[model samples]
Target: MSDNYTKIVQQNLHKLYTKLPPDLERNLPGHRNGQEFMFNAFGEKCTITPRAITLGDANYPAIHGILISLYALNATPEICLLSPFKSFREFPDSMPYVGAFTTHTEQLLEPHVPDIRKSAALITRYFNGEDVPVQGGGDFAFTLFPLPKIALCYIFYEADEDFPASVKCLFSNNANRFLPIDGLADVGEYTSKKIVDLICDVNSPS
Candidate 1:
């Protein structure tokens, strides 16, 4: 299933790339040297060329597929402010992916509770390298531009005496312009997992 998804993503990327205007490509937020598109993904520098997409020095197939798909489909390079943290149901066409994010968050993030400090630390480190500013929301809050036009705000609320730690992922009001609700969900899941893995890596013994 994952391999199929990657193939589909790649096909869509190619189709979209062919239709994209040259003026739009020039204005894209990343470092575009000729036909290549470049940007920071997590802490790694990603370059998207006509033949292949690479993350740092290695070929990252899945990430390349998703990111390039998003870039090709992106409507504009203009960014908007972070919207209020809300459930997926609050956004039109986003209700379908709510269950996936909910399940992932409950099973992975909620169980950690007060240990949200680790998640917070990982986010700080990730964004710090990208030069993206992270501001306080609950326990930790930051706005990330996974693509130049796509902005996602992640807020982690620390556990209190009565409740467990909870996470809220919100997107810019204009998110639907770039990708569909399902694609947004994939982005959310991918981002959450990346942070979780980073935290685990930090805790692991070398």
Candidate 2:
């Protein structure tokens, strides 16, 4: 991201932190201890402190920005479990700009089947090890709880005789309770990119 974007995120965080009610702050979902909040970032536990957001011992700037923005918005973890999954376009009143990213989900994974499969395997193995449920959908699928209330589903379809491998990213219908469509797009893209990178590393020839 750009320096300006980073500054903007920091500013928004500080503004939202000040406006948050004590009761709401204390009860915010996922994990919490005083002003520090915790949640899973790409399968790893991370803590959001007043000074900085840390994934283990290291600081992840991108995750830090995303988490702070979510917290500042006071995102709730109450997912609409009864609602069926929906694509970004299906979201009510979704902005037109987001269609560019949402509509091209398949194209994004067309060239990365090997890495995508590897990534999905790793996710299944590690998450199952921790008892997180992984559901099957077109080859591979799983639900990710980036925030307590926000759930993102990633589905990967294997290449067939007539079609190339593809991926679809979906969100819970109630996701609007947390961030706007733009933020949701950011979260989805970021998570997708992270998964691809992890898979590439695992499949890299040594």
Ten-residue segment with the worst summed lDDT in candidate 1? 127-136
Candidate achieving the largest lDDT: 1
The C-alpha local distance difference test score for the whole of candidate 2 amounts to: 0.61
lDDT of 2 at 53: 52
Best by TM-score: 1
- What does the lDDT read for residue 27 in candidate 2? 38
Q: Which 10 consecutive residues of model 2 have the lowest summed lDDT?
A: 126-135
In model 2, the runs with Cα more than 4 Å from the true position are 24-27, 59-67, 80-82, 103-106, 124-137
lDDT tens digits by residue: candidate 2, 43-152: 56766555555564554546447554665465554444514767787876676746666644435656787666556657544323222233445776676655555667
The Cα error of candidate 1 at residue 150, in Å, is 2.4
Off by over 4 Å in 1: 1-3, 59-64, 84-86, 105-107, 113-115, 119-122, 128-137
- Residue 168 deviation, candidate 2, in Å? 1.7
Can you write out model 1's per-residue Cα lDDT over 1-206, one digit (the tens) per residue? 27776677667657756775576554455677877777765456767665556676654537547655566656575654455434556778766778886776434565554444645655655644222233445666666565556666766677789877777766767666666777777666676666666777767899
TM-scores, all models, native as reference = 0.79, 0.77
The residue pairs found clashing in candidate 2 are 77-148, 77-149
